[model samples]
Target: MKKHWSVFLTTFMSLLLASPVAFAASPAPQVNAGDTAWVLISAALVFIMTPGLGFFYGGMVRSKNVLATIMHSFFIVGMISVEWIILGYSMAFGDDSAGLIPGVIGSLSKIGLAGTAGQIVSGTSIPELAFVIFQCMFAVITPALITGAFAERVRFKAYALFTLLWSIFIYNPMAHMVWGGGKLFALGALDFAGGLVIHILSGVSGLTLCLLIGKRRGYGKLPILPHHLPMTVLGAALLWFGWFGFNAGSALGANELAANAFVTTQAAAAMATVSWVVCEWLHNGKPTILGAASGCVAGLVAITPAAGFVAPIPAVIIGLVGGAICYFAVAVLKAKCGYDDSLDAFGVHGIGGTWGAIATGLWASTAVNPAGVNGLFYGNGGLLVAQIISIIVAYLLGGIGSFVLFKIVNAITTFRADEEEETSGIDIVEHGERAYSQSIMTGESLGLPNEFNKMN
Candidate 1:
């Protein structure tokens, strides 16, 4: 009996000692000021991407509506900011009130961002406020992205209303479903950034609005190449810089994973650019700088969903495919579909996002990130299946949701301006400003709407 008791005691002591060692060897919970600071800076970086998007879209539009186009993004930033703080964050991340949608609309009250400081997120040491600010940038840009669809037309009054409603109904719910500690987040779906919530949703919604609003004045008759490629290139450069924050910031830290995400983001963007140039050169006999810029953006969108999951090598593969696929999607598919996307938002963001979702399922390896599941390449078929389901659900829901919302807006306000208003230019007719008064101007000022400014 004495010998047996001694043996049991020794085993218990050994188990106690080994347990802590095992836990220590697991993913470290260590935190430092540097990582936290990097995340805060990263949050700011993502915020700048919206203005960059504004400039890129503004430059491609006709000179008549340059300022108006830029205003679309700018106004969205302001409008969404107020809405996000008031109701958007609660709808997304507020506690699961009923387990139905998680967070009641009125539970957190309007603009009541109290008790958010010093509160840690479930898995990390970063404060909840850090996550809130990081996510606010996403809410700011998603709706702004849709402005490209109805560019050169649409009344600003109706546009503002549409932007507000869309953010509340569409963007917020999707963000909650995907990342707000809800059903989709628990379903093993992989979306490191806003590929589904931001890019895919915006792209599909833009396509829907364009379809409902009808084509622009010229339709298929006139050539409308970019008004200023140089401006577009500059905008693209800004987006490239801002994307490091967009992708890496999703990690919410300045650790090895953030570094990995940063490197992968750069590698994919480079590879996608090259792939686009090659494909364009082969098909059109020469690659333009415009194509290079488009390719870079396409690569950036494609890699967003997979940035934190896959390793560097697969990221390169994803980029190469992204360039080739998005080029065909824009140049060939849009032409065949006859849908006036106006800016290829669907082609680049939608198609590229789909590719990234699938590639993530194929390339994710647990060796690099044990917290994340391994993909098919790493002998896990279940994760690949889950990824496919996520893509299907996101596309169907986003596409159908936008269509319904646009239909309702169409019933209330005329989606398109009259023919004369469209032809004369939306900037002068809708807004009391002309983007270029020197080149072509009537005797009257834009706001007066006198006989000289009247449409012929």
Candidate 2:
């Protein structure tokens, strides 16, 4: 009996000693519950921004086209959400070594979220799944941002097709370059959140598409005013609320960096709001609610790149300058260029994001985030150079890629609505639905002449 017990103990010890060697190649992931919770919650917050964007763009279009405009955002939420799960995530985040174009995009190893059950995100204590969903929200919102540029006049089928392709070809590649260890990441560019990845790419692509799609009917000849100011204000509020999650969540941990991002985001937004109102009041003789909302959004866009790398004081300056510059872009540059960017997507986001990226190079400091390097103000001009190069790269990718996609989608389906469809309203023409039933009963749904329909 004693000899048998000794044999059992010896066997158990041998198996335990051999287990480490067998599993040495792949260590277990260490996930922090708090970090995982924060990332997931932040992802949910970002998800709200898409529908919030729908309301924002929806309120700015003519009543007849309200539902169609909102549908652009709503449908993208569904389409891109599915695309992310299937291929977008893999293309943006899979192993670069196995990628179709190494260092330019990710491989398909993570297709359908395979091999992600217990993996931890690199450099973080959260599950890879959490990171995946967070990035998915970003993918969903980016193309939705473009709809505002060509509001009220695009064909639904063309928009759908264009969005899907853009996500795969344009968005995925750019995201990989900036955040997924691609070219820009290797070049030492610093985009704390998504100045280059999300805002610049989306804004530039919006400009390109709007140019290709041409202006809305009677764009220069007639007035095109927002139908609901209150709704626009509401949407703006939601965007501001969600932005905290957008910027702070990039830290990927519940730590000091997240707190710094939160503070800077508020500071920049408030200062930009004040600056925009002041500028508008001086230029136009009265401060408008639209200007205030737009200013706040501009500030948000500008601070996004610098949120985790700069101090609050620098953030305020970034917002102030961003608000003023974006206002000029929307009020002066677009008017001078004579190209219709329907809701000022290019003016606000394009210009704001540009300024934000530059500001990051000017004000970034390692004191704020040890992982980040110093910027120009901190005696490192190389960071600024890297930022500029990244900006130029983003512009080329967004502009050229979007132009090609626009032509492709247009060939497959007519991209623009006909004159009759434009005159009657795209909502009924495209979706066979109206936003407000009262308009249908009152014959207002036909977009007949009304007090609000004054010509420009």
Candidate 3:
């Protein structure tokens, strides 16, 4: 009741402020110290998540492929960073892009950050440059997420090419449609952050790559254990830490909405962690640290879309749903489908993201944010319908788009490494390097032949 009153008062006040008299007296938008600082800091936090993801995924693959796995995420940071300022950012956020299909892509007007610099972002206090760098962090992580699916057997050069193309064709357009003032935004679909743009897109793309690239050699035939568990836990910690910025920062201001998002983000992540461990304990007789980590991430993904529009309790419910749903996706569904989705990227991020988006429609409240709509529980089912539509669109596009991108990339050059390279381990075969120095110490001690030691 209090929240309802608050929403009513806020709305009433907004109307009053928007009147003709208020418009003339209102101060011009200027740089806001707090919002700018928070957003920039949030960008930095998000930047750390890619390497953290590398550690999380790296720890899950076999020791021989750890370096290769880490390299995928680490290198995308540099690759996408360049791509962003070059043309990627323009394609994503450029205002003038009424694309070939209107709202599907941004204009190339801002290519190379051409005319966008220290100028203020429209309706925001931050400089255009700040928004560019902040969004670049998101672009970097999306492709890195796909690397987990095709981890060991992928040719690095081919993977690199795919990353370039995927960002251009798949990621950039999707980002534009949702957050870039594109069709979805125009249609009233509300994505506070990037449940559709990032998670769903990457998850579907990850699955597509797995099918196109084929499974890692000896996938189900042999148990491939994590080379290191502690690294994964550390990576999860970093991801959770970074997500506060990802969720809260999306508010684009250090205001009540940002505070709400911050609190909801933590609540969802914590609840999901508990729910995941509990779910695993009941089913498997013991809950592993991996379950806990996976659960937390699932929770984060689930709450992202709802962070600003729902209260803490709903966030907890979203997390619980995410935890259980993702567990089933990875454990039961993956086995039945026979796809080796290494690290369960499709299960965790994809499923969690979809659920989170729908949950937004179920739990969102005008009371929490008048700028947002009420959800089904709050007496509107229309938002839920839009959420479903966005989910379907994302899956279809990500799947079909990834397939085409793979065909194009493969026709140009082979995407998969040869059998000999796979057998020898990708780190040594492709990079001429090892993840651990201990391999070197043990190599000479074992008295292996010089040719064998070459790892090729």
**Best candidate per lDDT, number?**
2
Tens digits of per-residue lDDT for model 3 on 1-456?
Answer: 999999999999989877978667968668888888989998998999999999999888777788999999999999999998899988988883455456888888888899886588887888878788889999999889888888888888899999999998889989998888888877677789889999999999999989888887767765567778899999999999999989999888789999999999999999999988998898889999999999999999999889999999999888888899988898889999999888888998889999999998899998988889999998999999988898998999899999998999899999999888986789988899987775553244578665434331
Q: Model 3: runs farther than 4 Å from truth?
A: 1-26, 96-100, 438-456
* Residues 318-401 of candidate 2: C-alpha lDDT, one tens digit per residue: 999999999999988999999999998889888899999999999999999999999999999999999999999989999999
Q: What order do you get sorting by TM-score, best first?
A: 2, 3, 1
Per-residue alpha-carbon lDDT of candidate 1 for residues 1-456, written as tens digits (9 for 90 to 100):
999999999999999989988887857454456767887898788888888887888778776677778888888878898898877887777665443456312234324566676677778867777788888888998888888877887888778878888888878777777787665666887788887778788887888788878777665666555666787888789899999999998888888888888988998999999999999999999999989998999999989988988899899999999999999998898889888887778888888888888888898877766778899998999888888887777777667877887777778887677878776767778777876653353435445444323321
Quantify all predictions' global Cα lDDT against the true fold: 0.80, 0.90, 0.88
List the candidate 1 regions with Cα displacement exceeding 4 Å: 1-32, 97-111, 440-456
Ranking of predictions according to lDDT: 2, 3, 1
Name the TM-score of candidate 1: 0.87
Alpha-carbon runs more than 4 Å astray in model 2: 1-29, 438-456
Q: What TM-score should be assigned to candidate 3? A: 0.90
Residue 174, candidate 1: Cα error in Å is 1.4
lDDT of model 1 at position 124? 80
